[model samples]
Target: MVCSEFAGCNEAMQGVIRYNPFSNVGFIEAMDQAMSLTPEDKERRMMLTYEHITKSSMTQWIDGFLTDLKHSFNPGQTSYYLGINFSKKAKHKKVNRLMQVRQGFKKLNIENCSTSLLRSNKCAIIIEIESLPNVKFSRHSVPTADVIETIHGLLIDKRNTIIIVGKQTRETLLNWFGRTHSFNGNELWFAAESGYLYKAGIKENWQKLTELENVSWIPQARKIMEAYVNNIDGAFIEERQSCISFNYKNADQEHGTMFIHDLYNLLDKSLKGTNTEIIYGNGFLEAKASTVRKEKLIELLLSKLTTSSKLDYLFYLGNDSSDEPVYELLKSERAKNMFFESHSNKFICSLEKKPSEADFYLEDVDSVRSILEKFYNNTKKKKKIRSFADLTKITNSIAIESQRLKKGTVNASSIANLNQ
Candidate 1:
């Protein structure tokens, strides 16, 4: 049985058996059904979802987003061709500017942008990695080995790469990045707490709170929050450096919504005139300083990178509401002026049909990997290899050549060798 909570319901609706664990009887029944299912029944159900999963090809996803973006700025030019005919003979010119953003740790697909830059001279990638969630309730921190490897490969390309993390302090992120393998001070940048803390060489920090939170507010607020949660079975509060998060995951769906509304109302009345800002997410309420935001960080990064020349192309991929501002900013006149006139792509990670500011939707983590891998494998070569066999042979040859060069074993006669 697949016990689905919030967002997993969409998966259950497709083919999987879904159960709400909050109800003992419902949970047991679903488990029984799963255990008793025949092989034929399971096969039939799995086959039903095959078409759903393969309908959106990764290439189609990228192409569709780029096509839509091309018409976005000048809709009046209805006859514009949306096809992107990547030229193999195209000269490897320095792209004046290339900027891309992705939510960190949610998925290991940041390599997609780096792979796109294999044909360019200089580019930038800004990623935001949220703080690791507390390891309570059987939740273990996942390994980021693949993520680290991808980042290292990008660093090898000698491009401007910045990783923004929600560390408690700037020094923490600095130390962490320092320990990462393949890290070079000249090639990579680190930003902590949404660009509020970052290396000075890249850009100056510009995040400023309108009015700082009162020092006494958290203590008083915690008392009221504790008193309120004491009566509720599943509600709990976690204190942070600059904010407090109220989680309602253990509550049933209906009661959880009611509890959230009541708590928001109660907190609003109790914390009136305080400087804390109450923010609502899927299953949690975060009361934080108003200055804690990602938009300013993104703006500062873009401003700093774009001064020398306008952007050649920009792409931003994110899966949260915080990402909306970044999307809106890229579509603004200021960004337009900084970009060589063309369309910019914004992709949202989504589960079901939903309204979003992004131009396209990527279904889930697997889709993220699929599209990213496609971009990573893409390269420009002068020779046209028609078959998979030919492509494989040439790719192997290039790999061997690269290995020889790295090992300082290249023969003099091979100096004049060409791909064709």
Candidate 2:
């Protein structure tokens, strides 16, 4: 390659000829030198260039670009993009800055909890079931088949498994599970509508924890939201049994923001003094009964579970702000006095480790499933002999076979005779 002695030009390489592009005479001289090379020299240069090109191909270049991009977004990693090296001190500072940006989304250490669960005789797991905006099949979304099967195993084994969802109705949650796999839902519980509605089991009818009389403003609120969202492209209203949400996830950013503020004000003024409250986050605005709280439902469920027996371990997994209060409740001093043994362990995990009440954070929904599957596998009971006599008989048969082998009753000659 004949090129100017600029940034990427390696002039020392055999296949490369560098010229001062600023000097026309030098550039012409370098071009003439390149053309006058003998056949052998041309072949040698071509071979060297071919080798260099093969070593630094487009794939490698793309990979380097992507790595650099990743480092740019998630700073603090030592980057070696385009042959530029970052100093250790600089990397450390970047790392600290990244930590600050993360705002306490620390990596979850599930090993200890897994070990503790295995040793514990009884455990309960609570999972939030709301998908984050713009995320597909999020941890808070419906459970996958593997996750379903794992939870099934836990439930069949009599582990208390409760699902808490904000927007999904009990019917939708059931359908999500039913599509994946069928299992006994006797021990499983569903807390839907952010705990305003709940069902004890699959066969059980959904019961309201709070009366609908308080949420009489829902119909009017839904009508107002529906009318407001009609003008905004890609914006819609999602109506639940006791909650209505304005979803602007697909709307233009500026329009969504403007609509959210206007919608909040509209609802705030229209629903004044009604038993309803407006809450907005990320990509949506929600209006629900003011009395609906997920943490209270959890406390009620825990009280119910503890009535039968004290829990040995409790695990709570959530992905959004709605679950944050539960995390706080679980970690509170008053929670210590409720249902669990004094030495019982509790774990609060969030899908992302941002600033929150959760002590540990998982990367995504897949991580949540992976850890649960690990726990299920770790706690699975080993197969045992049906009876002691069956064990003894198997042992004696093995011993007798060994004695026969020692006596040469099962020799190669005997086998050959039998074949003959």
lDDT of 1 by residue, 1-420 (tens): 254432322332356676543346667888899889999988876765565456646687588557656544642332122332222232331111112222221333445543444444335545443322222341111214454444444454333343443423455554444443443444455655333455533334423323345546677667656754665567777665567767664655577675565566556666777765675544556566556665666666667666776454444545444555766676677767764345333222322223344544455444544443443343222112224556797778877887787788986456336355
Which residue ranges in model 1 land beyond 4 Å of their true spot?
Answer: 1-121, 130-143, 165-188, 199-215, 224-241, 247-258, 339-354, 369-420
Give residue 297's error in model 1 in angstroms. 1.9
Scored by lDDT, model 1 comes in at 0.50
- What are the Cα lDDT values of the candidates? 0.50, 0.66
For residue 273, what is the lDDT in candidate 1?
A: 78
Model 2 shows how many backbone clashes?
A: 2
TM-score per model over all chains: 0.49, 0.58
Q: Which residue pairs in model 1 clash with each other? A: none
lDDT for each residue of candidate 2 in 264-354, tens digit (9 for 90 to 100): 7568879999978676545678898878877788888788778877887888877656777888788888888777788888888877645
Error of model 2, residue 243, in angstroms: 1.2
lDDT of 1 at 231: 57
